[model samples]
Structures are given as structure tokens and as C-alpha cells.
Target chain A: MSTPLLSQGTPPVVRKKISDPLPVRILLIGLTLLFFIGFVFLPLGLVFAQAFQKGWDFYLEAIREPYTIEAVKLTLTTVAIVVPLNAFFGVTAAWAITKFSFPGKAALKTLLDLPFAVSPVIAGLIFVLLLGSRTPFGSWLGEQGIKIIFSTPGIIIATLFVTFPFVARELIPLMEAQGRDEEEAALTLGAKGWQIFGKITLPNIRWGLLYGMILCSARAIGEFGAVSVVSGHIRGQTNTIPLHVEILYSEYNFTASFAVASLLVFLALTTVIVKAVMENRFQKNSSQH
Target chain B: MGIELQNITKKFTDYTALDNISLNIASGELIALLGPSGCGKTTLLRIIAGLESADSGKIILEGKDTTNLPPREKNVGFVFQHYALFRRLNVYENVAFGLKVLPRSKRPSKSEIKDRVEHLLKLVQMEWALKRYPSQLSGGQRQRVALARALAVNPRVLLLDEPFSALDAKVRQELRRWLRKLHDEIHVTSIFVTHDQEEALELADRIVVINKGKIEQQGTPQEVYDHPANAFVYNFLGNVNVFHGRVHEGMVTLGGHSVDAPDELKNSAEKTSQTFVRPHEIGISKIRSEGNDLEGTIREIRLLGGQIGLNIECEGFDQPIDAEIPRELYLNLQLKKGDRVFVTFNKVKVFACDYEI
Candidate 1:
């Protein structure tokens, strides 16, 4: 942190009596590059390589298939439902935790980060145990003619559990750093509580909120394990793009699976670019303070 | 009618922030709550502004009991220490925010708000920065905008918590003058809290000195400075030398010298007292003469800008006594380090013996 790297554009090279050897720095950089290319870059390149292996007409036919199109719609709908709910939960959680004091504050904060630590599969299983038809509430839901487990609602709920922490985690630190003085100033100026949040707090945290929402949306779209366990693979009803990819690959339809995966690849690249821009602005804003 | 506080006390678990305190501010009078850090001055200001609520107390504003009212209904303007200008809003919007947030029935039209905001910006001399955000302005300019924004609602009272302390020394001085002129024009009963004695003395019509969660004294600047109520008031207002002594028959005996003590000390239950004497009040002579109750060697002579500071090491005191002399008087005396000099007090402040403890 004392190095200029974190706060500003330029990172200074400090030369003391002892320093890292030239070979060691090069070795560190080279190893990271090798690992990235081997595990990450090559797989991504193969997705595009195989997507076009058949030709443009075949690629278009694969994506335009009814099941694939249905999967795309389901994924977009899931993201639309999950993202806003997650965002509302994130903003409220951040506001409550950062803006006030309560007895169980420490415990609540630790629980907010639980989703990040819990495995995606385990997160899906928690909801299954709570709401699946085998349990009493789940059985009651069934007797009431409601189908929660192995349905769209069940998949959406499981996805919610896994992608819950992104927006709140991003907002908590940012809002906490920008303390309550400005809000108090607004109150003195006769602004109502909601007005203060809408005008003052929102503008301050807009970029960070956007960053978290993007990450949350991306996580909701590409999630495979949790949605798989909960969805029950009801084709054309609950199969998301990631689950559809699994189905196509399992059937040995290599061109279609890679074609679907290339969409994910493009989404991932956009996410990386957006994350970089948001992270840059966050750093600059923090430093300016 | 103005503002009144009755037995306002605040305790933070174990430490008391404000002891049972009561004060009243007259209408249209500008006062200052002046003290060192953590002396409960800012706390008192916040409680008055309704940002803080005092436990078991009443805040009467213009003959209305408003202790439980929120800041929005309290109708008091607070300018924070570090000008809390909304970073996202431009100067014009920041100033118009108060007017626009008013209830629709009481709110003015768009053109009226525009004219008022423009007028306020012109009043604060920040018209050129109307289109600029707070981040783009310097500390002084942001503070000016904060002042303009605070005054936009035309509240009955204005409270500033160390308004100029965040700026640099030169800018702070300039802003003090600017604020005084502004207060004169608007005359909205204002109370500012500051720790700097000079700022309190120069800007405030009445200065309230607080320490250890209690009001030590409150009066006009001249009254507090010239006739301090007690030893704490004397020392807190300015630099002074304290001589520990005992009083007998209207005289105080200390450090091989006896001086006329205040008349209250003669018949007081406590025989011991301390004499407070300002450095400038105690004149210095090159040679021993009549009325020279103390003598010391000039340990150091420092020219501090327009004035000369002399540090004298005298017997019976472990620390050097600091004295200031005008540059003109210093040059005439041609004083030097290691020079022997005798000191005499022109006036002395006497207080009960427990003051030192």
C-alpha cells in the first residue's frame, strides 16, 4: 500500500539496500502468464474455434434450435428476476449494516458473506432441504397445489442464494467509507429520508452498485451447479443456458455446445472490460477522498 | 425570544460529555462556544441544531419547546467543520436543494428558487463556481458554498462547528472576516464553536468558555479576556504564568515576593490561592528596581513574525515562563539571551487554591 500502485496511476520502484533479483520478477510474471494461457485462454479460444467448425449456416441453425432458444429466454428471465431482488437486498443490507448500530451487527455481517464462502452446490441444497416437497412446508406447499422444487421458482431461488453477496459486498465498504456526514447535512437542509437516499447516497454509490449488479447478473447467468441440482432438468421449461450446454455436450453435439459456450465467452469478456472500468473509477474515487 | 437550554446533560456510558448545563442566547446575537477539543462545545452545538438529542433536557427555540423535533423541523442551519458539500451536486443545485425540499405548499416556483440561489451565490461570492462540483473547488471555495447552502433556507438560527478550522491558516483568517460581514448583513442569530482563542475573541460578540464538560465562563470577548472569572478562564483564554501562593491580609506571598491579592482572598475560607498574570502584564527591567517581585535570566529571545517572544527561567518554577513583547519594544530594549532581568506584575488574577489541583 505504501507503494504508489494502489492509489494512483504510477507505481514507484523503491530501491533499498536489498531488492528482488531480476530473474525472480521475470519468473513470477512468466509463471502467471503460462498458467493463464494453459488453463483459461486456450479453453476460451477452443470454444470459438469449434463454434465455427461447421460453418455460418450450421452455427446459426444450432443457436436457432427451439430448445436452445428456450434456454436463452429462461436464462435472461432468471437474471432479470434474480438481479433486482439481489440488488434490493444488497442495498438494504449495506445501508442497515453500515448506517446504524445493532446488537447482532457482527453476526449479521458475517452471515451476509456466508454465500460467498458456501459452495454453490451446498447453497442449492440448503433451499432444497428447506422447501423441497419431502419436508413438511414443502409437503404443505404440494398439498396446496404449489410446485416449488424442480420448477422455475425453485431454480430462481437457488440462483438467488449463490449470487446474493456480490452487490452487498461491493456497496458496504464503499458506503461505509463515504460516511454519514453528508446525509446529516442533508437532513439539516430539510430533506426527507428517502430523498436523502435517492439524491445523495445513490449518486455516491452508483458506480459501485453497477459493478456489483453486473457481477451478480453474470454469476446468475453462467451458474451451473446450483441451478442444475434444483432445476431437475425440465427441458424447455427450466433448463438455463449453462444446463443446456451440459445437455448438448453430453449428447456429443459438439458444435452446438461450443456455440452456446461462445456466447458465454463473449459475456465473460464484456464483464472483464466493465469490471476493469468500474474498478479503475472506484480506485480513483477512493484516492480522491 | 431566542434559544434556551435547561439542564442539558449527556453521558457516554461512563464518561460525561456534558454536565448539567444551561444557557440562553438572545435573539440576533452571534455567540461562540469556544474551548479545547472534547470540551463539549461541539456537542452543545449539535444538540441545539437537533442533530443530537440531549437526555433529560429541554431545548426552547423562540419560545417553542423543540427538544424532540428532528433536524428538519428544528429549523436550524448547521455548517460542519469539514464543509460537507454534496460532491455530486453543482453549486447551484446544492444551494437550491433546501428550497426545493420544502413542502409543496411552502415551496417557491422554479424562477424564484433560481433567483434566490443566484442571490445566495452572489452573497457568498461564489457565483462563478455555480456550474462546478464540490470536488473541483478548493477547500476555501467549498466552505463558501457550504455557507451559502446553509443560508438558503433562511433558518432562524445558524450553527457552525469549527467552520474555518479545515482551511489553512491564511484562508481561515480571511474567511473569519468574510463570515463576520455576512453575519452583519443577514443577522440570523448564529453560534459557532471553535477551539482557537483568537477566532473566538475576534469574531464572536459573546464567548462561552467550556472545559471538562462544563461552562467555565461566558461573557463578551473583552470581559472574558480582561476579567476572567477564575484561573481556568484566565489560562484558557490566553497564555499566562501561574504562581502558586498563599493569601494573608490581602497579600499573596510566592517565589520570594509578596503582592496585593484580590479582596475576596483576604476573608476566604481557603488561605492558599494562585495568582494568574499574563506575560505582557508583567513588565521586565534590565536592573533590579522597586516592585520587581520576580527576577529571571532571559533563556531565549525569539522574533516570531511581528512580535518578540521571550522565554525566562525563574527560580521556584520548573518550566520557563513565556512572555511576549511588541517588536518595537523589543528592539528598543536590545534584549539578548542570558541577560538578567527583573519582572513585575501590573495586574494580578487571584483564585482559590483548589484551582491548581
Candidate 2:
């Protein structure tokens, strides 16, 4: 409601507006839109369009192929194994770094960021060098009849390396900011270490953990370079969705390649939607505090 | 329970947080560890609570050695400065957390826990917030819940770390009174750390002044306030005006006036000394009543609710001298800025210049 005295007694004062001029504002917005369309939206749209160029029957047939089905299963299995292991590692690493003081703390922090800094292909190669059948440890493992490189385990390891920092990076700052106050309070109240972590620390960082898991799973599903190096292109056995797409494309199977690529695009879109929802919930929860 | 610390010391890298110190706190006594930031007051409280370990010391609680006990085994309730309530749990669950975390054999039944939580919440006057999360509550309310949660385990001693510092001025005052009342009702051996001298004075039965990892003094609030042990304690407890003067026989000459020095300094050799006087200990007059009174012009006048504070500029003193008098007395004197007035020291404390703060 307007104040009657101010409305009747005086004219509104002119205030200096803080904004860019019209043309500059329009130009910046126009450039951002053009970049998004060219670099992001168009490629995503082209995947689905090209996948369905022939017909629904052809698209369905390509998706139903044995190799394609096996690729989907392998991808799901990789995510299923990688995400939980990484999540466990993330929570433990975050808890150790944030809650305790130890020698080489700075070095440990730098090592955590190693996954993000090193190339995924190089990570795959490092594992190969250490675990390949030619090395002493690899030959020892070979004597034990356990194959790691160029197998499902190798694919899992590569994905684990690349997505290692997600959950930990998300939770380190969150837990650090939350501090050890609550845990100390719990301990003073006669709660054990696990009780404090389960009843206090876990719940406090739940949203952040979920957010990191989602990002990890998304990367695990669509990982290309590292998984490619380790999988050995063993058709239905070792080929994941991205690797399968590459194989199909290089073999001149255009329709099948696009169809498989479209699935990844769909998965990426779903991840984006879930991430947006999680972000909204996280903001709401944090703002309430 | 009673707490005793023998030769407690703590260090962080090169900085010593708590020097070798010893103290005894009687059961059911409300003690305030008062100090400036980084003076090791919080460290002492944490050590007693078993949240921190002294480098070499023995902690005796209720006549039992508890130096190596973990916080869980120490049976001390701690309320953090920020409240530290579980962000995800509602008030009821937060209060029930301690009891719920007890061993299965020792834990109370469901109905018993519910009754206890409800009673504790009511004790803190937060029963109506049973279903509300900590995020929905005010700072004072969160602190109340934190206290309730701490009390759920029925600890023998309660430790509060700057409990009221996070709240606003009005809320801090209100909660200070509330905490005092609660301590009276429960009669638990409670120790709270605070940097606010007024809070310490108003809430603690006894105040222990700490500075640079050493105990300066410990006494009842009135005793410490009236008779400080040293220069640091004198300057910390309240605002005071300092007079740089010399003690030559039994009298100390300050500006143009001379007053009898303290007995300890009076018998010492002739040397430079510093005289300390609280704001309310100085008197102002329109005319020089005593032959030893010093004259100065009022440089600033500040009305402090029930009292009037005047900053007087004397000829020899580099800094203006502060004097506070009753509002009624100010009205009678009709004092204002630029008025020339005579000032007299009502009560003075003398310390040798070598004892620097």
C-alpha cells in the first residue's frame, strides 16, 4: 500500500538505476544464448533427431540388439559398483581429513585432487602398468588366476579413478563448515563415535552426499576415455554405452551409433533434472538453518 | 561433581594455550573462566570436560582420576557456543539423542525417554517447539534446546562454552538470567567460559581471571571487582582511568595532587607507579574542595542511562581522565562540555610501573 502523505504531498524522487545500457545487456545475453545453442542444445537435440531418422521400428530394433543390451547392462553394473565404493571412500576420506589432525595432511589433500588433475587415460595406463600381466605384481595376480586389466574390473577401476573426488569434494567443505562442535556435544552427552557419526554427522551431510553420488553416477555412466582404454573392446562383454557407441560409429553403423548415443543423452538429461531438484532441496534446507 | 586440575598444561605447536595451572571447583558451584580471546579459558573448560587432553596433568572428578577418560566416559555435559543442535533432528529428537545413544542394557524404555525428553524440554521452556527443527528456532531457543539435550544424560557436571555470546544483547541478558535460575534449580557443578566481564560478574558465583595461559586471580565477583590482584586484572574487569605518577614516601603524586599509596607500594623504594581508578570512583566538583584536587575542563559529556560520564582534559595528563557520577549529581552540578571542574580520587589502586599488563 502507498503512503497517503507521501503520495499527495510530494513527487517521487528520481533514483540512479544500477544496470548496463540496453544494447550492451542485449548483446551479452544474445552471446550467451548463441553459445549454449551451438555448444550444448544443438548437439543434444541432434542425438535424438538422428536416432529416430529412420523410424520408431528401426530405433527400437537398434536398442533391442544383443550388443546394445549388453552394453547398457555393463554400464549399469559399472555404476552400481563404482558409485557405492566411491561413496564409502568419500565419506571416510572426508571424515578423516576434517575431524583429525595427522602428519602429511596437506599432502593427502593434494592427493585427493590428483584424480581431478590427472588425465583419465593416464590413470587407466597407470593401473595397467601396475596390474598388467607383464609386471611382477600382475604376474603374481596372474598366478592367482585373477585378471584385472582389460576386463570388467579394469573398467570399474578406471571409472573409480576418474570419479574419485566427487563425493569427497562435495562433503569436505560441507563437513568442515559444519565443524566438530556437534560431534563434541554428542560425545559429552555419552554418545560413541559411531553414534555421533550416524545420528549427527551423516544426517547433516546427507544432502551433500546425495548430490555427490548423483554427479558420480552421471560420470560413471557416460565415462569414455578411461573406460575405453581399459575395456579392450570385447564386444558385448567389456563394451559400455560410450565404448559401444564408438565401436558402432567406427564400423559404419550410423543408426545404431546414434541410438546408443541418445541413451547417454537421456541419462545426462535425467541427471541434470535430479541435480537441479537436489540443489533446490539443499538450498531450502540450508536456508532454514 | 567437584573437579580438580593438577598442573594442567596444553600447547599448540609453538603457542602454549594453557600453562601449568591448577584449580579446584567445588561441587554445585557456578564458576566462570573469564578472559580475553586466546587466553586459554575455553581450553581449561574443554580439558575438564575431557574434550581436550592436557599435555601432562591429572584431572580428578568427584575424587576419581579421570585424566585419561574419553568425553563419553567423563559424564560431563557440554553446551557449545553455537548451540550445535542436530540440524536434521526436531527439538524432541535432539533432546532425546543422549538417552537414545546409551547402551541397550542401560538405555531407558521408549515411554520413559519420551517423558524425560518432554520434562527436559519443559524445563528449558521449549515444550512448544517439540516438533520444530533447529533451523526454525531463534538463537536463544536453539541454545535452550542444546542445554536440554546436554542435561538429558544427567551429567554430574555441566560445561558451557560462551553459551550466550552468539545471541543478541537482549536475548543474552535474558538467557544469562535464565541460565542462572536453571543452575540454581539443578545445583550441578557448572563451569562456563566467557570473555564478557559483565556476563561473568552477573552469572558466576566466582570468577577466575585468565591471561596468557596463567591464572591472574580467582574470587567471588565482588571481591575480584573491588580488589584486583594485579594491573591486568584491574584493567580487564572494568573500565578504569590510569594515572602515571611517582610514589615517593607513602604518597603518590598524580598530576598536581598527592594521595596515599597502597600499603604494598608505600613501603617500597621511591619509583614510578601507576594509579588506577574506576570511573565511578572519581568525584567531580565545581570548586576545589580538597587542597590536593586537580582542575580540568570537561571535554565530553555522555549520559549513560542512570549515570553521566565526563571526559576531563587536565593540563599534565596526555589522555583525558574519565569520571562517572550519578545522573542526579550531574543535574545538580549542571556540568557540560567546556566547563572547568575539580576532580578528586575517591578510591585508587597503586601498582609499580614494572608490572606491565
Candidate 3:
């Protein structure tokens, strides 16, 4: 065996095992768990405790009130309008940014993200400056009896402006990363613009679109600062769930306020669960791919 | 379908991806667009397929000017480099997508679509994978599905962009043979883009070698290989030993030694020249030659498959000359590294050098 072994070649070298220290790895794991428990789990537990402490009777009574019921209805209605609108805006903006090059593209990108950095309070004020009685367009609109300030419509406008960036921001980088070749490939295969969008582009970006929608819906429901400034507090009218909760808290009704807050918390938590499920589905899709 | 591109050019801001170029591709002829990366081969293919619009050009297909027509109206099929098969749809549905989405007047019946998909699946030998998604298939299987899907529409022409680049060597070889067989059976005018010279040589009826946004050469594989138009074409196609020299009065001087020029080059002007010879064409012998041989020392030797490649160090040459011979020849000569050998240049090509190193 030794006589002929030299003629062929030497066997490949076995690589050495380079591993992190076991103690350091354990410490890292411990630190990660500690941070999650302290920062994320504790507050979540507190919200759950407050939600169930009063039992179903108190919760039902609180939710059945006209003010509370109206608030819930208003919040859902706002979400119904905001989610689809933001989804459309987000996807269109992302497609425009990723696929097309035109004048003021960088400026358009900056403007798309401006609402995210600016506070919702400031967002409400910007609309006020444009649509309030102070501006010429506001006066013209007022003459035509088209009011866009200090009402439910104003609250929607503010929420829409503040939550504008969520969907597109999520999708632009994703669409870019997936690339433009697939779309072009679809087009070249006898697919028109709409067909390509429906078949190739939409299917590929569906998960990202859902992710953005969930995030935008969550943020839209929990919006307080923008809606508060624009919504003139009238019971069962301009008052949204968040603004109503603030009103109840001011009246020293801590339990009811926390209860309403917990309901909003519940909606936000549903969004989190949806995001988790969506992420898990995305993971499954990617792994199968 | 016959395709004509007249003065096609595409510019992405400052970078000119495709300079003004024109080409004609006859119907039922498979062509390979071979080039290195960023050579605008894919761009040209895309322009023909209508996936990308030419900045200024006329795309005439079968005597119809279709420069402004979109891809959906072009009636051409395209296969992407990544396959680009719909991951959500199974093989059958993916192939049937184009037919299903056709306009009411052009739409096929359900059974017709099914039959067409089945026929294409059988043609690509992928009938068993009708229910499998792209992710579920291997690279070779996915490429077959892509080919099947491209053929489902019964297109006038088929285009493939590096269809087998993502596969392993064994799968690539298998697919190459399968693709050629598929093309011959279908008799579709196809254009496949690749940077691999081996793939181009093995497949295309004619190879169009593109370089730096221009067609460097286009001809049959043997014609391009045996008689390259320039140094770039020769070096890009395959491995060859290039010896820089000077030609004067029907004589070529290489490595301070004179060699008689071939009769074809008898009327050559007195000019600096470069000699092109394949490594396999050169032979090393134990018997020393007189005027036909150069004395050199073997610097290194490599046993590659059935051939032995030798780097010979000769006088007046900075770079070692490389020669490849069969293992039996090396065994007969008892050649090893550091052994002195006589290298002979039997047949060589001479070209006037435009620039010198």
C-alpha cells in the first residue's frame, strides 16, 4: 500500500475545529434571555394582568358603553380606510422608486419618509397650516363647505399622513432586492403591464406587502398624538379610542382608561401575532424554495 | 422567427451598455451569444425579446416592424438565467400560465391548454414533474420546466439566458446535450446567452462573440476556433501559446531563432508579429532537432487528465513557453521537471501586432 500511495496524491487535510469558548457562549445565551425577559416580557405580562383583573362583567360593561362602542367602531373604520390606502400608496411608491427613474426621485424618497421622522403632532399641524382657515386654499374649501380640520375626517387625514411610509418602506428594498429581471422576464413572456404586476411582481412581494400592512394597521390603530390634535373631543363623534382613553384618564377613571388602553393593546397584540404567523409563513416559503 | 436589429443602442445615463450595433438572425437557426460579463450580450437578447426597449432602433420580426410593441404583443418566449419560474405554481400551471391569460379571442380551451402543457412536459421529458413546484425540483429539472414553460406558448422564437450556469458541472453537461436535442427536435430559432466558451462551442449552430458592447466575431465554432480574426478573439476562445516575434522577408524570428514561414505568409511585409500556436500542437522529443527545434529547460510539469502540460524556459523569452502532450508521449520521452527538452514549432499562425508589451 505504501509503495503505490505516493504516486496518486496526498489525501486532503482535515480542518481544525475552531470554536468559541463554552463559557462565553453560555454567557451570551444568558444575556440574550435576560434582555428579552426584562425589556419585552415584563411589560407584556403587566398588560395581560390589567386586562383580565376586572373579569368579563366589568370588561363587557366598559365595552358596551356608547362612547366606548363608538370609539371601537371609529378605530376599525379608520383602519379599514387607512390600511388599503397606505398599502396602495406604499406599493406604488415602492414600484415607482425601484423601477422608474425620474426627476426629483431623491426628493420624493425623502418626502415619503418625512412622516416617519416627524412626530404625529407635527403631522397634524402641517395639515392644519394647509387646510385650516388661515390659508387661501382653506378659505376656498371653507367657502365650498369642505372642512378638513378638527373632525373625524381630520383625524383620518392626520393618521393617513403619519402612517404613509410604512408599506413602501417595507417593500422598496424588498422589491429592489428581488430585482427587476423577473418582471422583465414576465413582460417578455407576453405579459402586459397589469398582468406582470398581478402575476410576477405581486406574488413575489405578497409577504412583504402583508408585513407592511400589518405594521401600518398596528401603528394606525395605536395613533394618539396625531388623532388627538385633530379630533375635537366630542363624545361618540370625533373621539377615537386613544383620545377617549386619554379623556377617561383625565377624569380620574383609571380602571376604565386602562381597560380601553388594554383593548388598544389587544389590537396591537393581534398585529404582533399576525406578524409572527406571517414571518413563520415567509420562513416556510423560503425554506421550501 | 427571423429577427432584424437595426442601429440598436441602450444607454444607462453615463454608461453606454450597448453601443449602436446592428445584427440579423435568420429563422430556425440556433445562435449562442458568448461573451464575458457586462459585454451587453444579455441586453441585446432582452432588446430582441422586448423585455428591454432599445434607446433608438427598429426591431423587425418576420418583415413586421415591431420596435414599439411590448413583450406581450411580440409572441416570443424567454427563459431567465435564474429560471424565474413561478414558485407558487406547479410545473403544469406554470407552463399553462401564458395560455390561460390570453385574451378571449386567443384563449385556448381548458382541455387544449392541458393537452399543450402535457405535450410540452413530455417533450422536455418532465411529464412526471407536473405537480412539482420549482423549489421542489433540482437545478436540471427546474431548467427543463423553464424550457417546457417557454415552449408552452408555441412561440416563434425562444431565448435562454445562461440556462445552465447555476448548475453543477455534471448537470450542466447533461442539460447541454438535452437542450441541443430539444432544439433539433423542435426546430425553433433560439438564442442562448453564455460567457462559457465550451458551452458555446458545444451548442450553437453559430457563435456570436461579443466584447465591450461590440460583436468581436461571429461564425461557425470551427471557423472561429481555427481562424480567429484578432488576438482578442484567439485568446478568448481557448488556450493557446502566443509567442511575440518579428517577420521579415518570409522568415519569422522567435526566441532568437529563425523559423520558415508558411507559404500563405510568403508575401508578408517586414513588421513586428505575434505567433499563435495551440499548446497541444507543440511536441517535446528526446532526439535533438537542428533548425526546427529550440533548446529549453523544463521549469514545471502538470499532469492534467490524459495530457501533460509543460512550462519550458527558453533563451530570449521572459515568459516560459507552455506545451501540452499526451501522457504516453511524456512516458516515452521520460520527461520530468528540470529536464532539458527540444521544443519544436510545427505549425503556427502569424498576425501583425498593433501594440507591443
* Model 2 bad stretches (over 4 Å): A1-21, B355-357
Supply candidate 3's per-residue lDDT for B195: 93
lDDT of candidate 1 over A69-119, digit per residue (tens)? 999999999999999999999999999999888999989999998988988
Count clashing residue pairs per candidate. Answer: 0, 0, 1
TM-score of 2: 0.95
Q: How many clashing residue pairs, candidate 2?
A: 0
CAPRI-style docking class of model 1 based on DockQ: acceptable
| Error at B124, model 2, angstroms | 1.3
Candidate with top TM-score is: 2
Q: Taking the tens digit of each residue's C-alpha lDDT, what string does model 3 give over A75-156?
A: 8889999999999999999999999889999899888889989988888888888788779998898899887787767888
Worst 10 residues of 3 chain A by lDDT: A1-10
Q: Quick one: RMSD of model 3?
A: 5.2
Ranking by DockQ: 2, 1, 3
Question: Which window of ten consecutive residues has the lowest lDDT sum in model 3 chain B?
Answer: B260-269
lDDT of 3 by residue, B20-100 (tens): 877788888889999899999999988888878889988887778878987888878899998888877799988988887
Instruction: Give the least accurate 10-residue stretch of model 2 chain A, judged by summed lDDT.
Output: A1-10
> Given the true complex, what DockQ would model 3 score?
0.36
Q: Please write out the lDDT profile of model 2 over residues B202-305, one tens digit for every residue.
A: 99999999999999999999999998998899999989998888988989988767889888887888888888999999999999887878989999999888
